[model samples]
Target: MSGTVALITGASSGIGEAAALSLASRGASVALVARRADRLAELADRIRGEGGVALVVEADVTSQEAAVAAVRRTVDELGRLDTLVNNAGVMLLGPVVDAPVEEWQRMVSVNVLGLLYTAHAALPHLLAAATNGRRKVADMVNVSSVAGRVARNGSGVYNATKHAVGAFSESLRQEVTGRYVRISLVEPGAVSTELADHNRPEILETIRQRFADVERLEADDVADTIAYIVTRPRHVAVNELLVRPTQQQA
Candidate 1:
């Protein structure tokens, strides 16, 4: 990854932040995108302290304009774009019957639309890199969830968004794999992150109880999976990767 420039959304925390650090450590110039400037700055400082090149771009991926600008800014500042991690997403879980429609809107906006906007903006750059850059191959890793594969009672909207991600990733992969741009989907079963913090109090308690006996995965664990996907040889394209904790069944 020495000559690569990778941009990651939701990069201020969780799997996004971990992936940024991991790629930077492997010698990739990383561009961190997220809504939080302070957190991005903190992560950038950490990466720079380790002698890695890190660029911080503050943007909300839910908006198409912001998403496009983030991608453009990354390419302009980093010289080239080799990898895109569409990791900006939100999970607001609850029953759909009387649930707040705002949660559903938020999930669709970030998980589905956000991914689309970033991919749309970054595809041309990724293709260009694959054609002319050092690696001769580019990667797009979409961070989905196990919820994408399994639809539970309380997470209907979240399930829909992730399922959409899986569909989009596969279709895009088929379209671009021959072009040397690898599109991959990463589904994580259950990770300990701030994702659950956005749930309502009632829903949060239910989730806590459901996973109380299970040892959830760490952010770095999923980050390692992402690193493995992008670092593979050009011929070896990891199309889809599902990571689950040893104790997680679904």
Candidate 2:
């Protein structure tokens, strides 16, 4: 990873932040993308303090223009892109009936549209990297969720969004794998991230009750998975990885 450059969205907190640190420690220059400028700054400071390279790109991925600009900015500043972590997403869980339509809209915008926009913008760069960059391989890691595999009563929309991610990742992988660009999907179960905090109080209570007995995974756990996927040998592509805490049944 010494000459690699990685751009990670939702990089201000949780799994994205951890992944940035993990890759940077391994010698990749990191570009942190998120709407939170303050958090991004702090993270950049930490990376630089540790003798790692870091760039801050503040943008909301939900906007297509912003997503495209984020990708271009990374390439303009970093000179090359070797890995992309599409980690920005929203999960608002609740029963579909009588639910606020806004919740569903938010989830779709962030989870589905944002990922699409970012991936579309980064595809050409990733292809170029795989063709001519130092490693001769490029990686795209889309962070999804267990909801993608199993749909439950209260998590219908969230499930739909994650499932969309899975489908898109697989199709895109098939289209790009021949070019030496690896597209991987990572599904994590019940991680302790801000993903669950956006729900209404009632929904939050239900989530607490559901995962009470389960020791949820930390952000670093999923970040480790992202690092592993991007660092594989050029010919070896870990296409899909599902990580769950031991006590998590579904």
Candidate 3:
């Protein structure tokens, strides 16, 4: 991974933040993209202090223009892009009957549409990375959830969005694997992050209580998996990784 460049969206916090630090630790120049400019600058400064390359691009990947600009900025500043982590997402879980329609739109826009916008802009760069050198490799890591794999009550739209992500990852993996571009999905069951805070207060409390007894997977856990995937030899491609806390059954 030395000398390679990776662009991670939603990098101000959660899995995206962890992945940025992990990639930097392994000698990859990282481009951090998120809406919070201050947070992005902080991360970039920290990485630079540690003698790793970092660039901050303030963007909301949900917008197509923002997504395209983010990609172009990474290439303009970093020379080339070798890996893209499509980790920007939102989680809004509520019963379909009474949930706010706006919430559903936000979730779909970020989780499904945002993923597409980012990936659509990044495909050319990723394919270029594959033919760039001896590694003959490039990576696209989509951060999904267990919700994507199993349908459950109270999470219909969230589940649908994640399922779309999984399907896209698989289909694109087939399209580009032989071309040396690897598309992978990291599905996490639960993690102690702000993902739940985006929900209604009562709902958030209820969900948090369910994990009160058992420690959930940390953002760093998923980040570590991402680092491991991109750090492997060119011949190695991890198709998918499912990470759930030992206490999680569903």
Q: Write model 3 residue lDDT over 61-140, tens digit each, in one string.
A: 89999999999999999989999999999998878997899999999999998899999999999999889844689999
After superposing candidate 2, which stretches have Cα over 4 Å from the reference?
A: none
lDDT of 1 by residue, 30-57 (tens): 9999999999999999999999999999
Task: Tell me the RMSD of model 1 versus the true structure.
Answer: 0.5
Steric clashes per prediction: 0, 0, 0
Q: Rank the candidates by lDDT, best first.
A: 1, 2, 3
Clashing pairs in 1: none
> Candidate 2, residue 146: CA error in Å?
0.5
TM-score, cand. 1 vs. native: 0.99
* lDDT, candidate 2, 1-250, per-residue tens: 9989999999999999999999999999999999999999999999999999999999999999999999999999999888999999988888888999998999999999999999999999999999999889999999999988999999999999999999999999999999999999999999998988888999999999999999999999999999889889999999999999999999
lDDT of each: 0.95, 0.95, 0.92
The C-alpha TM-scores of every prediction are 0.99, 0.99, 0.98
lDDT of 2 at 24: 98
For model 1, the stretches where C-alpha displacement exceeds 4 angstroms are none
Which residue pairs clash in candidate 3?
Answer: none
